[model samples]
Structure formats: structure tokens, C-alpha cells
Target: MKRRDLVIAALIVGGLVLASAVAVARLAGDPVGLLTRDAAASAGLPPYTGVISTFTVMVWFAAGTLSAFIAWTDGKHRRRLAPFAYLLLALAADDALLLHESVGPRLGIHELLIYAVYGLGALRIAYLMLGEERIVALAFWTGAALLAISVLVDVAFLGAYLLEDGAKLLGVLVWSTVPLLAHSAPRAAVPVLGLDRALEHRSQPG
Candidate 1:
């Protein structure tokens, strides 16, 4: 990475640590808790209990990172991939924090409302992918379909935790393939300004 990129990354990490300390202090009056214990220990639960959720969060984060990398490196496709980067990152944060299920409820924001917002975000992504390669778009659509089904099962099947979570996990896995597919697909030729003029000059019996 460039020195500037490294510096920016360091600043971001530092800011995150500072913000987290402040938040912890405000909420629990003990910033030490943020550093001293793992989440499972703090919750009095076995570490394995959160394994699946942790995996899901990791996948979401990985997808976001991949999308961001593509956006940064491929100027031609940056506009299309940038939104995916942001949305995937937001999803990762929401999942990691249980924002929709727990925090949103406490804040009087209905879980359904949060789901609707996410649904619209997914639709926006689908629309953006309309001009992409068919295979890549198809994978994303399949992932979205699986996620929709997971949401449906969550609302209707109530107690079918295994099925709902399984579908959701599969959806995330499929969705995460989009960045990889995009990165591997042949890039279109980028137009170079004045190239034609230069070629014409060279061709003119020089």
C-alpha cells in the first residue's frame, strides 16, 4: 500500500478505538470492559454459542472489503461497486451489533422498518448490477432471493431457527461472490484521450 493509504488506515483504526472507548464509558461507565474481556465472557455464554453469528459477520466484512478494493482499483467500475461496499459494510455492522434485533428495539425503531430499509438497499444494488455480466448478476439475485426467503421464514415460521439462519448464511455466501466475479471478468477497454490524434500523426508519412 502507498504511504498515504497506510496513514489513512492507521488514523481510521485510532479513531475507531477512541470512539469505542467513549461509547463504552458513556454506556457502562467502564471503558476497561472494552479491552479486558471477550464478548462471550461478558455475556456469560460459551464462546461457541456465537460461532455462527461471528462467521456471518466475518463474511459480510470480507465482502465489503472486496467490493471496496474493486472500487478503489477499477476506476471504470468504481461507481457501481462503491454502493455495494457501503451497503455490505453497513450490513456487517448491523449484524455484529445486533442493531436491528436488539438496539433498534430499544431505540423504538421497529425491526420491520430496518428490514424494509435493507430490502430497498438490496433492490438498489440489483438495479446497479443490471448492466453487469449475466453470471455475476445472477449470483447476486440468487443471494437476494435466499435472503428474502430467510426474512419470510423469520416472520412466518417463527421457530424454524435452523432453516432461517441456514438460508441467510447461504445467501451471504452467494452474495459475497459478486466482487470476486467482477474482479475476474475481463475489463472493458478504457478510452485514452488524444490517442487517435497521435496515431493519425504517426500514420501521416512521418
Candidate 2:
């Protein structure tokens, strides 16, 4: 395997191990819980909230890395994709910086504005993807829908931090898979399981 693949594997494995450890800590109510509680106290948030936020950061980092790799490899040939790459980077930055949660409130801006910016970015990416890879387009739409639901959950409810974060992570995972899926199938650029492919195969000669 390539060095990049090795690094990615390590990151995934490490993240899994860390998540397991956190789970164990929650069950045991020992040092891990104590540490997490202390950290939460310092941060003035719930313990699980800190844990969820940490995992969310990991997801964002992984997404950003994948996006950067896609931009580096594919953007060389398709210059228009450079903007998509930058969009992913901006997403990572927004998550890392908590731009909406932090800066938005300070500037008298609502989270809706942040969502609008993200919506515009997604729309631009969809426009760029027009007539290109249909699977990627579907992935983008699916991710957008998932993220929209996450935003709604956050806005409409209270004390659902874990649920909100889980939804956001799921959405990010969907988005992260798009570039990988597009690269995985060179001929069709999608998993060979959809009705479109089924119709095409059905129409083929025996």
C-alpha cells in the first residue's frame, strides 16, 4: 500500500481505538470519566458533549484530508474541481474554528446564515458537477439532505447534542465517501446496484 493509505489506515484504527476507550470509560466511571468530566467542567459543557465534539473534530479532519487528496489528484486534470476542493477545506476550517457556533453569535449573526453559506457552497459544487459524475451528484445531494436534517434537529430541539452531532457526522461521512466512490469505479463512477444500471443491463443483448 501507499504511504498515504497507510496513514489513513492508522488514523482510522486510532480513532476506533480511542472511541472504544471512551466507551469503556463511560461504562466504568473511572479515570476516563473523571478526566472527561473535568475537561467538560473546564470547558463549561457536558462530558459527552466534549467527547462528541472530539469525535466530530476527528471526522472533520478525516474529511478534510480526503478532500485535499482528491483535489490534489483530480484537480490537476479538472481545474474547475479546484473550487470544490477549496470548499471542502473551508468546511474543515469552519468546523475546526467553530465559526458558526462562536463567531456567528459574537457578530450578531444567526446559525441560519452559516447554513446559507454552506448551502450556497453545496449548490456551487452541484453546478460544477453537472453532466459529470452522476453518482457523485447523488452523493452530494444525499449529504446535503442529511446535513439539513442535522441543522433542523439542532435548531428545533434542546439537549439533543449527541443526536445532532451524530447526524452531522453521518452527513460528513456521506460527503467524504463521494470522492472515494467516484474514483473507485472508473467506468460507471458508482456502485453497480442502482436501477439505472439495471435498466441498462436489461436492455443489453443476450
Candidate 3:
């Protein structure tokens, strides 16, 4: 990954966070009484009683977009395809989120797939980052722990979807990892043109 790639990753994660904030806000400010009940039908759990204002939605959505971007772009460090694929997968869920308010359970499958991919991608990134010996510090350890916890949180959502409606709100926990992932390891530089090694090294910048 190049420095520019890292910057882009940060931007993507920021976008996810932003998106999530917007989602929660809309749920709260459902002008026409869309959210008749604060409780999630699948999870059987109540929604947050706190005011879900547009400002909250804006902030959460931005963060969600940012995190979703990071999870989607999972392989920028080595294999670009991995990240690109994940981003596309996340989009399915993002779109599902847009219509879930009116669709009523029809889009749960899409949302579920998104959460699964997001969790797995997050786990992969944490594995890579934690492999670095230098990441044994307090901050790094905290981040890694959070990533691990996110996997469980995602799993909880899966369980809720499959069994009860009590845990549908689990996504918030996993998406929170976006900010942590934004602080990434130093990326490898994209070497300039070097004809001598062009044929020998495929990854070398042409």
C-alpha cells in the first residue's frame, strides 16, 4: 500500500461513520412515525431512547461510511481485489439500509451479508496489523481488542437475525472500529519506473 492508499482508506472509513450517524438519526426523526416502536422486531430489543437528531444521523452516517469503506477495501496492502470486492459487498447492505424502513424484513438478507463481510474483513485487518511487533502498545492493543470484540458483535447480530430480535442493534459495535482502522501502518512506497526490473517484478510500478 502506498501513502496515498492509506489516506484513501482513512477517507473511506470516515464515510462509513458518517453514513451510520445518518441512519440512526433518520430512525429517531421518523417524521411520519415510521419507527412506531423503539424496539427492533428481530432483536426484540428497544432502540436507544436518546434523541436521534439529524446531527446524530450525520455524525453516525459519516462514521459508518468511513468504516464500511475500510472493511470494503480489505486488501489494499497486498491484494487490491480483496478490498474492492468487500466494498461492493458492503454496498449491498448500505442500499438495504436505505429501504429497510419501508420494506419490512425483505432486505434483512442483504443487511446480514453486509454485516458478515464487515466482520470478517475487520478480523483480517486486525490480524495483519497485530502481526507487527511494534503494535504491542496500549493504543494498538486496545484497537486490536476492539476488532476482536467486533467479530463477536457481528456474530451476535447474526444470531439475532436467526433467532431473536433482541440483538439487531449489534452493528453499532462493529462499525465503531472504523476510526481505529483509520490509524494505519506506514504503507510501502510505490516505486517509480525501473525498466531493469519491470519484467522480473510484476508489482513494480510501470
Candidate 4:
């Protein structure tokens, strides 16, 4: 790896370690228990209980990592892929932390409001992905449709864990393919708002 990449990785690891130490100190908990233990172990539940959720979180994280790597290296589509990376990372954090289910409710934020924010973020991603490769866009939309079905089941049925989580898992699986598809596709020039034109005008001799 390049020196710059190694430095970036070290900084990120250091920041995470520092943050975890601070959290453990303030929370008055064992660092391992608080930071390293699985949710099932912490809650005294069977390991299998969180297996699927853990898998889903891993998939989201992997996709986010891939998207961030692509965005960092691919300047031609950085504007589009950077936001996509951020969205994926946020989604992974939300799912892994149960922010919507536990943290949001405890903070007096409505679940629907949290979902609305996520929906808006997803819409923004869709808008950004516009004019990209058709196959990549199609995969994203398919994943989105599956997620929509999952959300619908969550809101309407509430008891259908199999259907809700099944759709969600399928959606995550489909969504994880986006970065790979995008990486393999040929880069296309995407226009930014008047920036190119402004640069062109500035280049002309007075």
C-alpha cells in the first residue's frame, strides 16, 4: 500500500480506538464488553438470534467500503459515488447500532421520522445515480423496490418477521452489488452545475 493510504488507515484506527476508550470510560463498562462483545452475548441471548442481522450489517459495511474506495480513486464519478458511499455507510451504522429502533425512540424521535430521513437520503442517491450505467442503476432500483416492500410489510403487518426481514435481506444483497457493477463499468462524464462552463470561461485569455 502507498504511504498515504497506510497513514489514512492508521489515523482511522487510532480515532476509533480513542473514541471507544472515551465511550467506555464515560459509560463505566468493560471495554471488551462494550466494544467487542456481540449483541447476543451482551443480552444473554442465543448466538443464532443475531446471525442474520450481523450478516446484513457486514454486507452493508462491505458495500460502503467498496463505494468509498471507488470514490477515492475514481475522480470522474467521485461526486456521485462519494455521496453513495456516505449513504451506505450511514445505513450500515444505523442497522448495526439499531439507531432507528432503540436510540431514536429513546431520544423521543418517531420511527416514521427516521424512516422518512432514510427515504429522503435514498431519493437523493437515486438522483445522483442518474445518467450512470443502466445496469448499475437497475440493480439499485431493484434493491430499493425490495426495501420498499420490506418497509411496507413492517408498517402494515408488523408481525410478519419472515416476510419483512426476508425482503430486507434480499434488498441488502442486491444493493451490495452496486459498487462492484459501478467499478467494472466504463466511466462516463457527469456534468456538474455550471462548474465546467465557469472553468472554460476562466481559461480564455482576456
Candidate 5:
């Protein structure tokens, strides 16, 4: 990455860390009630879990947008990329709006829809990653596995809301790596980009 990009990333990471620290301090029974739970409630803020979830949603949305832009403009594996991009975008939307929670319950299919979306997305990503090197594929699959586990934790540990949300947040952080790694790889190395050669050659001389 360029120096400017690195600087921006550092800034964002720093801000998130600071925000998390503040949230944690506030949640840890601070008697002063500085950024307290009651304050958060009154101000319509989401405290710690909300901060993490918001970051997750933003990252997913950005990943989706970047993937879609790559799919549209890149010469290789555009068709395969479309699905991953759409999935990320869908995930981001769901996280931001609680779409599944609102709509699925009304339709009496909450679990089914969540499982279907996430499961299919993970499977599709795995299938696409087969073209990558073994290590890359392994890393992505691991993230996918963690993502599934996070959802399970969310369901199984509902009584422990903090643990459930933390697990889910951890999974999201891991899953965020897949797209970043994929983006770093060369476009020419993509397995399904054979057709891209003809297009590239069309622009060059023998």
C-alpha cells in the first residue's frame, strides 16, 4: 500500500482503539458515569457492542464496494467476484439495518434465512478461493469457519450477551481478512481469467 493509504489506515485503527477503550471504561462500572450506560441509553448510543458492530458494518460495506468495483473494472474473474461482492454488500446492509431480525421473524424464517445467506456465502467464497495458493485458501477457509462459529456463539450464548457479541465481533474481524488478502493478489493469477488474456492481447502488438 501507498504511504497515504498506510497513514489513513493507522489513523482509523487508532480512532477505533480509542473508541473501544472509552466504551470499555464506561461499561466497567465506572462510578463517574462518564460515557455511562445510562448516558448511552439516553443519547441513543450503542456503547461497546455498538461500536464494534458499527466498525464491522463499515468494513464489510467498504469491502463490498471495492470488490464490486474490481469486478466491474478488472479483466479477470469478474463473474466470480460478483457473488462475493454482492454477499458482502448484503451482509453490511443486514448489519446496519437488522434486516433479517425485522423481516425474518415476521415471516417465521429468521434462522433459516440467516443460515442460508451465511452458509452459501462461505461456500461460494471457498469455491472461489480454490484457485488461490494453498496457504491463502486455508486462511480464507479458517476465517469462514470462525464466522460460522461466531454465529453459533451468538445463538448459543444469548444469556451472555457480552460474550455472544464479542465472539461475533471476533469472527467479523477474522472474516475481514479474506477480501483484503484477495485484493492483494495479482489479477493475472486468478484461475478464471483466461478470457482476460484475449482482451489484454487485443490492446498490444506482437
Candidate 6:
């Protein structure tokens, strides 16, 4: 890889660190904030909003974006990445639609839609990364499958009877699987993260 590529990788990963720190700092003691928003609303009140934690939210957004970027850039030059690109764009767009609102049982249009887009994006990326290598592919698929199943459960199977059982698991899984899935593609970029394979291949003793 060129020196510039290393710089870009460092910057992208550095952004992850910065975003996570912001999230940790700002979301601190605010786990209940979303719930609080809803609780207040029950009594006919306005939502109690907090200072926008760009890092907290943007960290995940950046992670997803970086993963997609790697897949697209690499796939375009070496591997068809149009689908992956579209999904990445979808994930970023969905992030913009986040409401951070309090709700009963995680049932809200914004929440559902964001997670649905996230899951779809994840699955698509996982599929793209499926043949990269054994261990890496397994991890990626596991995350994607969990998230896709979770969303399907919530969106398609959710109803009065299944509501209690279905949505709970689905909602929980969606949030959990996303970060795992988001990190998978970037992990696949490990080999290319440093050495330019094109150069390394030519330089190898024949």
C-alpha cells in the first residue's frame, strides 16, 4: 500500500476512537434518556433532549461508512461493489433518520426503519465478504445472519401474539449485531491495510 493508504487507515481508525470516546462521554448516564423522553410524553410533555452527541452517534456511522468504503474501493478495483456501495449509502442515510426517542417496546417508525436499513446493509456486506476467507467470513456471516433474522422477526413476525416474544429479541439483536457486523468488513481489509498486494505479488520469489 502507498504511504497515503496507511494514513487513510490510521485516520479512519482514529475517527473510530474519537467517535467512541464521544459516545462514552456524552451517553454516560443517558441510557435512560430515551426512556425518559417517552415517560415524559405519557404525561403530555415535550421530550427532554440532550446535547447532540455527534461522536456517540457518528462513531457508528463512521464505522459503517468506512467498512462500506473499503469494500467498495477494493471491490471496484479488484472485486462488483455497486450493491455494497448502495447499502453503505443506505446505512449512512438511516443514521441520519435516528430519533433517539423513548418508546414502548422499541416500537417506533424511526427505530424500526433505522434498524431495518442497518440490518439490510449488514447482510449485503456480509454476503459480499463471504468468500474472503474462512474464519473472517464465518464471523461476518454470523453477525449478518443474526441481524437479518432479528429484523425479520420484528418486522414480519411482529403482531399481537408474537409481540411479546418476537420484538424483544429482534430489537435486542439488531443493536447488538450491528457493531459486530460493521467491524467485519474492515477486518477483512487487514491484509491490504499495509502491503500493496499488487507489489507484494510481483516481488515474491518465483
lDDT of 5 at 162: 61
- Winner by lDDT: 1
For residue 53, give model 4's deviation from the true position in Å.
0.5
Model 5: ten consecutive residues of lowest lDDT:
190-199
Best-to-worst order by lDDT is: 1, 4, 2, 5, 6, 3
Query: What are the clashing pairs of model 1?
Result: none
lDDT (C-alpha, whole model) for all candidates: 0.81, 0.69, 0.43, 0.80, 0.66, 0.47
TM-score of each: 0.81, 0.62, 0.31, 0.80, 0.61, 0.35
Residue range 7-108, candidate 6, lDDT tens digits = 999999988866765676576855534433344466565555311322223443554455556555554222313454455445434434433223312564
Model 4, CA-based lDDT: 0.80
TM-score, prediction 2: 0.62
Residues 87-201 of candidate 1: C-alpha lDDT, one tens digit per residue: 8899899988889989999999999999999999988878767656666778888989998998899888998988888888898899899888877777552213323234334
Model 5's C-alpha root-mean-square deviation from the true structure amounts to 10.0
**Candidate 5 residue spans exceeding 4 A from truth:** 1-49, 186-206
Candidate with better TM-score, 2 vs 6: 2
Give per-residue CA lDDT, model 2, range 1-206, as digits (tens): 68799799999999986787788787887666553445667668766756766666677667657766766777321432456557666777777668888888899998889888888988876655543456776786788788777788878986787678778888887877766765563664443234334544553599
RMSD of each: 8.0, 11.4, 11.3, 4.9, 10.0, 12.1
Residue lDDT tens for model 4, 1-206: 78799899989999998787778767785655456667678888987996877888898889888889888987745666788888888889998988988999999998789889989988977766664567777788899999889888988898898888889889989988887787787655332332434544553599
Model 1 alpha-carbon drift over 4 Å, by segment: 34-36, 188-206
| Better structure of 3 and 5 per lDDT | 5
For candidate 4, which ten residues in a row score worst on lDDT?
189-198
Better of 4 and 6 by TM-score: 4
Better of 3 and 4 by TM-score: 4
